[model samples]
Target: MPRPASDKRERLTEAAITLARAHGLEATTLAAIATEAGVAQGSVYYYFKTKADVAQAVADGVAESLASARSTLGPEPTDALVGFLGAYVDDAAAICAHGSLLATASAGTGSDRAHREAIDWLAERFGDLGFAAEAARARAVHLLAGIEGGAALAHALNDLSPLEREATHLGRWVANASA
Candidate 1:
C-alpha cells in the first residue's frame, strides 16, 4: 500500500519533540528521532535539513500552542493574561517537560530569535492590556520564567501545590502589574 505525504513530516516533527523532551537536546539524534517516529532516518531529512530544524519546529509548535490556548481567553485583556498563566500553571507537569524540550533545543540550535518572537507575541498581548511597553515585556519574561520554574519545582517535588498556588499569585500579579 502507498502512504500519504504530510504524515511523515508531521510524525518526524512530533518524534523530534518527544525525543527532545525525554532525552535532552544534546542526546536526541536523528536516528533516535527516526526510530521514535517509526520512519526511515532519511525521511526526516526530506522534511528537515538538520536536527536543528526539527528543534525550531518544536519551539514554534510550543509557541503556537500557547497562542492557541490564549485564543480561548475572553475579550478582557487582563482576563486573557490570567487565563494564559493559568493554562501553564495548571498543567505545569506537562508544560515543564514540553517547554524544557523547546528551551533546550532553542539554545542548542541557536534559535533564540524564535524563542524571543514567542515572548514578543506575549509582550504585545500584554501591551494591548494597557501595560507600558517595557513593563509588559519585562513582565512577560518574568512570568514565563516563573512558570517554568514553578513547573520544574512541581516535577521535582512530585507536588502540584506549588504550581496551583503560583497560578493564583500569577493571575493577581498580571492584573496588578498591568494596572
Candidate 2:
C-alpha cells in the first residue's frame, strides 16, 4: 500500500533534517534525502520542487520547536532571555555542526516570520525588564546575532567551547542589562 501524502512528506522532511545536520545542507542532496526517506528520487520532486523547499520546511520545523521551547521559559525576563539564547545556540549548533549550512541558510536570513516573531518575543521580554521599547528591540536583535554567530563559530571550529563561551558572555550581558 502507498503511504499517505503527509507521511511521505514528513519522511522527506525528517530525512532532510537528519542529513542536513549530519553533513550540512550543501552536502545533503535530493537523491540522498529520497534514499534516506526510502522513496524514489522523483518522489522528492513530487513533494518538494527543490532542495531549498526542503530546507524551508526544515527551518519551519526548527522555528516551531524553538518557539515551543521558548514558551516554557521561567517567569523572570532576564532568565527567559538567557534561556532563549541557550535554546537557540544548542539547536543551531546541532543543526549546523557538520559544515554549518543549515545555520547559514536559515537563521542567517532574518526575513522569515519565525525569526521576526522571535525578535518580537525577546523584545517584549526585554521591555518587561524596563528597557525602552526601541532599546528592547535593538537588544533583542543583538542577542539573536550573538546566538547565530556563536553557533556558527562553534560549528565551524568543530568545538563546543565557542558556544559555551558565547553563552556565558551573553548570559552575563543579559544579567548586567537587566541590572
Candidate 3:
C-alpha cells in the first residue's frame, strides 16, 4: 500500500530533524534524510524542494512543540512564563548540543521566520501578563537573547545549571517588569 502524503511528509520531517540534531543541518542532506526515513531521495523533494525548506519545517516543528509545551503550564501568567522560560532553556540547550549542525542552521540564511515566530510567541506570552505592547516586545527580546546566550554558554561548558539559573533570573525580571 502506498503511504499517505501526510505520513510521508511527517516521516521526512522527523528524519530531517533527527539528522539535523545529530549531524547538524549542513550535513543533513536530502539523501541522508531519505536514508534515515527509509524513503527515496525524490520523496523528500515531493514535500520540500530545498534544504532551507526542510530546515524551516524542522524549525517550525520545534516552535510548535515549544508552544504546546508552554500551553500546558495551566492558566496562571507567572507560572506560564516560568514554565515557558524553563522549557526554552532546555530546548535551546538541546539544540546547542547538536553542535555546529543546528548552529549553522539556526544562524543560516532564511531563519527570519523562526526568529519572528519566536519573538511573536514571546510577545504574546508577555502580553498575557498585562504588559504594554512595547514593553512586552522589549522584554521578550531581552529574555530570548538572555536565554540564547546563556544556553550557548552552558552547552559549551556541558552544564545546563547556569542556563537554568539565568532563565530564573530573567523570569523574575519579567515578573517585575510586568508589575
Candidate 4:
C-alpha cells in the first residue's frame, strides 16, 4: 500500500533536518533532501515549494518541541528564564553539532515567531516581577541574544559549556531583578 501524503511530508521534513544539521541550510539541496528521504526529487517539490519551505517545516518542528518542553517552567521569573534558556540550549545542542542548522532555523518565520513568543512570555514574567515594560522587553532581548550566541559558540566548540555558562550568567541577571 502507498504511504500517506503526510507521511511523505514528515519524511521530507525529517530528511531536511538531517541534511541541514549535517551540511547547514545553505549546503542542503532539495535533491539531497529527496535522496535522504528515499523519495523522488519531484516528491520534494510536491511537498514544498522551495528549500525555505522545508526549512520552515524544520523550524516549525523545533518550535513545537520547545513549546512543549517549556510547559514545565517554574513560575518565578529567574527560574523561568533559566528554564527557558536551558530548553533552548538543550534543543540547540542536538542540532548545533553541525551548527549551521540552528542558525538556519533561527532565520525561518516559524522560529522567529517562536522567538517572539518566548520574548513576550519572558517579558510578562518580568512585568509580573515589577519591571517596566521597556526594561522587561530589553532584558528578554538581551537574554535571547546570549542564548543564540551561546548556541553558536557551543556549535563551534562542539561543547555545551559555553551555553551552560551563558545560562548561568543570564540566570544571575534575571535574579538581580529582585535587587
State which candidate has the highest lDDT: 2
lDDT of model 1 at position 10:
73
Who is ahead in TM-score, 1 or 3? Answer: 3
lDDT of 2 by residue, 1-179 (tens): 99554688888888887787787777888999999999999989998896668778777665665678889998899889988877755665463352254454475343275667788999999999999999999999998777767777877777777777887899999999951
Candidate 1 residue lDDT tens string, 29-62:
8898889999988887888887678778777766
CA deviation > 4 Å runs, candidate 3: 1-6, 89-93, 97-103, 106-111
Stretches of candidate 4 exceeding 4 Å from the true structure: 1-5, 89-92, 95-111
Report lDDT per candidate: 0.74, 0.76, 0.73, 0.75
Which window of 10 residues has the lowest lDDT sum in candidate 4?
Answer: 93-102
Ranking by TM-score: 2, 3, 1, 4
lDDT of 4 by residue, 53-161 (tens): 8778877765565567667897877778778876766666463542355457766544575567667887888887888999888877888778777878887888888
Residue-by-residue lDDT tens digits, candidate 3, 115-179? 56667877877888888889888877887778777776777787887778888898888667643
lDDT computed for candidate 1: 0.74
Worst 10 residues of 2 by lDDT: 95-104
Candidate 1 clashing pairs? none
Clashing pairs in 2: none
Residue pairs with clashing backbones, model 4? none
Off by over 4 Å in 2: 1-5, 88-111
